[model samples]
Target: MTHRRAREAAGDKDVLVLGVDVSRQMLGSGLLDEVHLHLMPVLLGAGAPLFAGVRAELLPLGEPVGGAATHVGCSVVFGP
Candidate 1:
């Protein structure tokens, strides 16, 4: 869904997106409020970077929840 559609569908609720390109679009367009990153142990080389075209911004991460994968939550801070 486009950002407007996503916003309308997600009124006063959270939307979990699993696609990298979609996430990039949301983040770049300043449509994301927070980000939760699930880091796994295994790595498969050759893929698009998460923050590829997004501008530099500070993302203060909260305490990580660990398990088979580590989950880290970050609040998106927009603008200088």
Candidate 2:
């Protein structure tokens, strides 16, 4: 889906809902212009799936973004 449609589906002003991609051993976030709420429960277990596509460059939320995944153990990474 296009990034613009994604945001309109999210319907939020203060928060930017993008995409989160997860592979066999890697997790990454994307900065799409929008995020589709309809796809929240969708999961791709093969290869590196695209969480979202953005037309512009994605900006990082901070220097270091840390998080805890129930299945991935401890993970510390940056977001864009």
Best by lDDT: 1
True-structure RMSD, every candidate: 2.0, 10.0
- Candidate 1 per-residue C-alpha lDDT over 9-80 given as tens digits, one digit per residue, 9 for 90 to 100: 989887787778888888888878788888897878667688877774656586899999998888877763
Cα lDDT computed for each candidate against the true fold: 0.79, 0.36
Q: What local lDDT score does residue 54 receive in model 1, on the 0 to 100 scale?
A: 75
Regions more than 4 Å wrong, model 1: 56-58
Q: What's the CA RMSD of model 1 in angstroms? A: 2.0
lDDT of 2: 0.36
Q: How would you encode candidate 2's per-residue C-alpha lDDT over 1-80 as one tens digit per residue?
A: 54457567768753443334422112233332322222223455653444333223334333433344221122233344
Compute each candidate's TM-score over C-alphas.
0.78, 0.25
